[model samples]
Target chain A: MIRDKLCAGTALGRRIADSRDRLYRVALAWCGDEMLADDLVQETIETGILKSRQLKDENRLYSWLYRILKNAWYASLRKNKGHETLDEELLADEAGPFSNCQQLEIVVQVRQAIGRLPAEQRQVISLVDLDGLPYCEVAEALEIPIGTVMSRLHRARKGLLGKMTTAPSGAMTANRILHLVE
Target chain B: MENTEYSLDDQTLGSFVDGMLDAAHSETVIRAMDQDQDVRERVHQLHLVKDLMKVGFGHTKAPSAHSKKTRLATWRLFSPRIAASVAALFVVFAAGMLSQPYVNGQPGFPGEMLAAFSPVLSDSDNVILHISESDPQQFAAALLYAEKFLQEHRSQGYQVDVVAHAGGLDVMRADVSPLKLQMIEMLSRYDNVHFVGCANAIRVLREKGINPPIIAGVSTKDTAFDHIVGRLTSGSWKYIRVDSLVDNPGSA
Candidate 1:
């Protein structure tokens, strides 16, 4: 008899569900497309369910899920590399075309700036800066070294600062800092 | 007392913002920031960038609640009702075994085994397409629809499993299916595409002294619908009824 208990109402399922938004956010930042990000998150959950048994440590649940999502993202990247682009249209509108609010504009700029970063830098930055994962955990999730994470994080931050601050001479430093959002 | 080892570089500043620095390094960074305007400015920039990134990308909406329930039900397949129902069915089968009048030494074949061994491939990312029509034209249209759907979704890691039974079994038979070459080609190209035939129907054909020729890559199960239902009850698979699409097999 097949054991149906593995995928059933286990603690792992609940934990995976709880981290859905976090996965989506990282996916959105990584791919810069809403629909593609949604697909990545859903695929990650399905894969996680099928292979949850391979996860040996329960304490590493979130990082384990992140690793799954990251691998899925890379697989997708490889799959679509030859014939198509990954969300170029999503990066086209960096000025918040859908909204007129000034506050949302900065968020759009930040998104655009982050989008322009190299993919490696973008991945590390989203995991660290956006998701607030610790350096070691981010390294573990990405399967990279801690020093690499730090170096990438530094470059990603510098790149974002340059794009946001050097946009034009229209705004002062104080106003920019005031507009900084949490 | 300058800590020459860990300078106030961008890497150190970003780590400081992330709380990723060791206690000693963090203390040194804090003291450096207190004494140096440049360090404070860089630290502020890192904080602003981090916060801005959070505010910008952290707002992606979670998937719909209905989709969440569907995913959970399909992936987990362990609702109390489902488990209880399966248990009750097993108990009923066992009771029937006891009530049956003894014949030869061998226990009569368990009736539940028929449903249990439906030859459904348990691949996680499956899409079941049901076709009950034996018309060559209908089969062609159904295959076309499936091909279109598979082309769009196959890259996204979905398996398109076709279940044919009763009159539909003709669609999987090598002699009868008009699209045999096409089916073979599809099976060759996409491992995720599957065609399953019902054994009960085959046995019925044999009882009538007629032999069935199944196509390559066409698998057989005890009951096609039973297997489909089992998979539907257990996993999040897309089930498509393609007869309606025969006339107007529009884009998938």
Candidate 2:
């Protein structure tokens, strides 16, 4: 009855479609391969549709979907551990190399850096920062305790700082502008 | 007041930057921020890391319309019960739409002006690849994707049509097409693949005294829209508007 709507129209189906891009972005950062990211996103959407009944609260659908995605990602890694790694990168390049490298340099570097992090750390930082999920929601999504989420986030930030961020010395700027009154 | 002042660790500062700090701890960090330049800088750098993560991933795009691939109906691949359900759902959706005004890019036929038409990941066995942009790289990418699709679904015998209209007409033009040899090769290889040039586009070009010759093995159509609507109404065909190499995750 109520669960039936999740399959049909404006609810779960459309929502799954809407989540594809962000999922691809997260998947890309995780795997660093566009083709694999596409496969991951597709798998996530399918799994989301198949397991819609497991989603008890519509409000928590995103977290549930992400959890499913994380699980699927792990499963894929397990499944492909010893498989022949044909250069899908070569096949992907047949579609033409990215011509806008200059425009995408910083973005590519950040993505590559994220790709370089340990899987657990990458997952936490992406869920927390890239996806803007709260610690609780990220914990729920990753199926980890909140403490683990914080620690992984700290490690991920430390990993990224040396590679991506610059320590520009400047006068301290206020996080918020505070006015002094007489 | 109990001295809420405490030493700040990297994790606490990271939490503070992420707004994960509890009230008392947050206040402590805020108070300390006024006194410690290093903490301020660490917080700023943490913020920069977060912002770069957002930006880098924010602007990251897939090469080509990956969503339009033979969708992961892996669930459908396994369970006939669910495949039946999806099939039945499509039947109902198509039936429901027939009674309404048939807009080209309507809800059931979801596609943006320059995005893939098959957002719902339907059971459609074929697609019409479209291009109206004169960009050479774009044309090559679309052709490459179309051929890859043909190779993958060769057994399924999927029908693919490349329709070029307006500025997209250049892709099918003999002298202009950057991928003329590749297009010709693909045309020979996949009998089910159709490459179309819009006469309406040719007329516009002709009006400017530029009568472009279309490549051999390609066909001419009256207008891209007519061909699109005709194929869509007649069969299970998705229309893909090839504007960029980016995987357009748009529903329409």
Candidate 3:
């Protein structure tokens, strides 16, 4: 029994370490802050290490782990007095690496569009697009019904498509058509 | 503007592109694409949105390599974003762009680095000073680096986070830290300078039957990596590994 528990613990640790980047990506997409997202992923991994037994099905581990991150983000939100987002002016003023570079500008536009999304929509989008978790896994991660996952993802994609269509910048439909056709 | 031969709602098209559709529904959409140029065009746009998303959020290693199956693999074969800037990965590192000048006799980022990386530095002037060594020289070097960076910067907004973990936890321990007085003085001197102890490290030490008391000025975090990640991603924070600053530390 002791050996089995130790083996299980070792496996869980490896999985947690492997999932760190994925968790970080989703957290970054969810909260829109690299630093906060990193901390959230670390906390989630730490909790997963300690509470591995709570997880009954290893197949659902990513979703279970993501649920912990979702809760941690919410806890962090509460700690900050329920400020879900930074002030738009404040966010606009913040500059990232290579902000002056042209390609970086397209990335900036994409991020700005995501920043404008409602938090729930943002969560599903990040899980789907960034983390590459399917609709079912995303639903499992956020503890929502699969239907909610699909709907939010649909709305999120619609929002992104709206941004692209309006801007006519970045790699949008027009740009693709411009490149695809003679 | 109407194609009577085949049609798909935006939601259905979005699902089909995302591989959320069942095999039968996906095949229907594929047939629609074969007959209608507009269907192909609209599907390409839906895919463009997802590709842009991956590029935007794929900051960590192998940005889009985590998943076992990617329905978008076909689109990647002809992705324009890849052609435009295959080298434009997220978060370009040019800390080397700065002169590794000496600050109070320790190698550190000079003030001129601020102007050199304006948008990245100007947005947030934060530094993380990480030390996990028990060597006295490395410890003193960290102290000097911290005090000098904070003292020399003209902007009061400049902030420093001292993260000590593993063997380096000794630097933040109340009974063990060699420069406890200096740490206390530094803490009192600058409001922006903060010291954090790793709770994970502390707990490990406790399990080993030695619970070293952490200094009063130092706060405890769940893990050092969490604190470090928070600092880096929260803003334009630079990381300084104490060991990298020196080749050999003099024994205590």
Interface RMSD of 2: 15.5
Model 3 spans with C-alpha error above 4 angstroms? A1-9, A86-100, A167-182, B1-8, B61-252
DockQ of each: 0.16, 0.13, 0.14
**Residue pairs in clash, model 1:** none
Clashes of 1: 0
Q: How accurate locally is residue A20 in candidate 3, as Cα lDDT from 0 to 100?
A: 71
Give the per-residue lDDT of model 2 (tens digit) for A1-182: 22244556647667776687778767766655555666777778777887777778888877887888788777877887663132111111111122222222334345545656778888888887888888888899999898888878877887776544331121111221011000
Task: Compose the digit string of candidate 1's lDDT tens values, residues A55-174.
Answer: 998877767888888898889879767633542312311222122123334544566667677777888889988888888888888999988888778777777777667653322232
Q: What's the number of clashes in each of the models? A: 0, 4, 3
Instruction: Classify candidate 2 by CAPRI docking class.
Output: incorrect
Candidate 2 lDDT for residue A125: 86
Taking all chains together, each candidate's TM-score versus the true structure is: 0.51, 0.49, 0.51
Task: Kindly give the stretch of ten consecutive residues in candidate 1 chain A with the minimal lDDT sum.
Answer: A92-101
Task: Please tell me which model should have the higher TM-score, number 1 or number 2.
Answer: 1
Query: What does the TM-score come to for chain B in model 3?
Result: 0.51
Residue B30, model 2: lDDT of: 90
For residue B135, what is the lDDT in candidate 1? Answer: 61
